[model samples]
Target chain A: MTPAAPALPPALDILGIAVFALTGALTAVRMRQTFVTAAFFALITGVGGGSLRDLLIGAPVFWVRDALVAPVCLATALLAWFTPVRWWQGQLLEWADALGLAVYSVFGTMKALSWGVPPAAAVLMGVVTACIGGVIRDVLAGQPSILMRPELYVTAAALAAGLAGAGVVLALPPALTWAIAVAAGFGLRGAAIHWSLHLPAHGGEE
Target chain B: MTPAAPALPPALDILGIAVFALTGALTAVRMRQTFVTAAFFALITGVGGGSLRDLLIGAPVFWVRDALVAPVCLATALLAWFTPVRWWQGQLLEWADALGLAVYSVFGTMKALSWGVPPAAAVLMGVVTACIGGVIRDVLAGQPSILMRPELYVTAAALAAGLAGAGVVLALPPALTWAIAVAAGFGLRGAAIHWSLHLPAHGGEE
Candidate 1:
């Protein structure tokens, strides 16, 4: 089944942020932190990756310059607060995370390229954009980061990012390349989620 | 007692990195990871905050483009690997961390100012420079970040950064302000280390 490919600009961005913020808020709930802490967690997780990307690529940080970003994150936190977290769990959460990861990976790579960053670094920037927010969130919550797991998390991002980079190098159309990259990334992560796919733990040693 | 005011460029930079790397490696040793992991931890903690600052300020990341930076970190890691961590414990490490923190806070603020970042952000840039590397180290090592501790860690960074920003805004001489900022940061952190000073936690109501 083809996941809906979101091609819109700021809306897609907002959706991704809201989903990630929801996840961060859920984590705060698990930690028994206050609503203030939940809002902080939501805001950070929502903006964290793009902020890191903008910083690295020497662009004005996306959230800092945008007044609406904060409101969107805060609203997302409030939305999560009033809702039962069970509503966000299971396949729906996984699917949303997969989409966010894929889209952000593509967006980050494209932005880095626009900034004249080197190609390889641009690819890595994609992974950074999709992952670092959760790393920051997990660190703050004193939990092991999802990246620390043996899963296909970063691998999925890398596939999307690397493909986009290669497509750029090959002079592929931006629209087509983005579509392909997102689909591939989402597919990989979806499979991992369903099948519990993971990298070998400790060099496959006993 | 006055800490050594080493004004040399690159030497001071290397010294700061090496000391920070030593702390990262010691964390790894405590975590009982392999030497390679220790080296990875050392390199990341040494460069994490500066890397973050440079990225945010639109400067080239220092460790990325520089040859010496990696070597300094690796050498420090190797040294830590060979030494008994007990040798690194007690007051000496605290002193070194304090010195590194102070110097980095000043450097970060100055760099942000040079990049034309706003005054408040520049002050925050200072705290980010000195403290973020340790936060990253703590997170990667699966330990609660020192940031979560009720202590003067960030407060010391803020004092140095804030004073420097104020001085710059007041059109004070750079050298004198830099000296004052570093000294004040070092003194505050040193006092905390010596006296076990900390911020009040959660009303102490339990």
Candidate 2:
């Protein structure tokens, strides 16, 4: 079950990684950790999701094979380190994160499908690809994990991945399919951020 | 460079997994989560380290390929769920965790070496396999991650993995090498548990 084409163009892929890396660096900076810790956090956050996907799908880890990825993460870390924390204060980072989440989910699902992972699992792989890096960052930072919350974050990724999987199953053009998937995911996440949207708790605790 | 032998015999491998699964299950039970949550926790914790190792080394994930592993994890979760929490409140579980940590570290290192990973990276892989599962569990449980603490836990796994990597480099007898590695690791962790040992903070904060 080969995917019709690559899920993301190279530039966009790098952009996604860079965006996630920035989030990771900012996280470390907020904690007042040193440069080395920020760089480590950036690298792990940038590569965490895709590496897990490739590993699960029996492919070489993407960053290990590509010389450019690590350097890019390090550069992002440097940028974050040199910049003052106040420069990044706002919803811009959150918006960037949403974009990264959408694009990465599509890329991950497409990659999984190409590797012959079944469709359902492929969708899950997409979620893993988009979210695991942030999860790792949160966990390592000792922050409350995103997984424990009932936010619409994972739900948005699932929507994107599910649509991407369906698009491939229906043999749709890759460009249109990815565009719709990313837009839908980004829209949902953006709305959630703007309105502070959340999924209802199990027992309506709130 | 193919390894001279499998990292562990089938029985011991399953035992290690079962022990880890028990810890994961107990964690969820202690948190008052549902049976499904407990089972999920058990499965992830049981297979997490090995899966990470295999993914890093580009091997098929062990539990995914094996039919018996999931059922064993589910069974362990059931045992944890059905039994009273008082039955497991002691050092016994900690000791079992140490044993699992030791055995899994050695097994992970040997497997990485078999996959032709470099000596140092293989040792790191060993630590990842032995510790990442519990880290994930703690992260999900909203507990202070073990990574954030300067405990001797990771140090012990590193010792075991380092020894295992060294033994492989020296072309030592596999059985004897493994026994010694496991004993050393378990001993360190056991001593830490009994004596409340800790690594000094960066600035001697303790």
Candidate 3:
């Protein structure tokens, strides 16, 4: 199907990537890694999810072809390095991450749909877009993935992605649907992070 | 590039995926996971690298459209689950892994070159195809990735990919070039495994 919705604005896309890249650089810094590694983390965390989505959907990798993406990641890493890690404490990073999550989830679903992926797969693409970068970052840092702890991360993403996919399939207006999806996803994640809510774990196994 | 090389035989491709898939399933089994998780690991490890390569090269994902790939991975997972984990503690799996690595490395580089990626990038594509699946598997399993170890795995992949790319650019015959690339890659990996060789790590980093 032809893309019925407007393309995600390039500025918004850059902002989301920048925020995620900041978090990635922070992860590296906290690990006492070198500058090179910090840059590596930032780039991967910024583009990992989108790159995966592009790959899975048989599209060109976004960051590789885009002139601005790598520079943004690198610049973010440098910014993170110069700033003290302690300065990043509190809800600011969390809120930014939630924002990025919201934006990315919807964007991912839209891209997937445009690629002719099934509705269900498009929803999953949104979650992957919003979350897999962090997964890769966590894995690289040798930390337990946030996915294992059963926080509401994936659920939040699914909500946004699902809504976007449903909205498109139902022929709803794009702007209204995207707004609701973002708000819903961000709200859920915010509540989870603030209240330390966790999904129930499987008994007898970990 | 007219894909001067013939496609890699389908049987070899399936066998390679199967061997890697079994290792993935074994990791899940060792972690005391359910059959579902084992199957997940198997599928991811089997297709992870090739998917990454295709994404980078802007080609449709190979396994997504293939009918047989998922089934083979699932079958391998089932086999791994039933067999004694101890039975897998031999040189057989290692040999199989080396073989898969050799084939995947060459295949990845060729695909990238065919997609008009530069030689350097094509070499990297080879390494990604041969190694990233295992990386994803380890990440999902929450284990330290092989990238952290001083193994010659990536190096062997580089050798094969580098040679293959070089050979093609030099106008070598396809069949002979593929054979040499696979043999050299496997030989390097085999030597590393048999003799416990490792690339030197930074002294301070461990």
lDDT of each: 0.81, 0.84, 0.85
lDDT of 2 by residue, A104-126 (tens): 89989888788777776677678
| Candidate 1 residue-wise lDDT, B43-147, digit = tens | 888999988777765667778878898988999889989988888877898899999999899888877777666676677678778888988898778786766
After superposing all C-alphas onto the true structure, candidate 1 shows an RMSD in angstroms of 8.4
* Deviating ranges (above 4 Å) for candidate 3: A1-6, A204-206, B1-59, B63-135, B144-206
Local lDDT at B35 for model 2: 61
Q: Give per-residue lDDT, candidate 1, residue A51.
A: 90
**Deviating ranges (above 4 Å) for candidate 1:** A1-43, A53-58, A63-135, A144-206, B1-8, B203-206
Local lDDT at A70 for model 2: 95
Compare the candidates by DockQ and give the number of the best one. 3
lDDT of 1 by residue, A112-169 (tens): 8877778899999999999998988987887779889889998999999999999899
Q: How many clashes in each structure? A: 0, 0, 1
Report lDDT (Cα) of residue A89, candidate 1.
66
What is the two-chain DockQ of model 3?
0.14
Candidate 3: residue A57 Cα off by (Å): 1.8
Models ranked on lDDT: 3, 2, 1
How many Å off is the CA of B177 in candidate 2? 21
Q: Name the docking class for model 1.
A: incorrect
TM-score for each prediction? 0.61, 0.61, 0.61
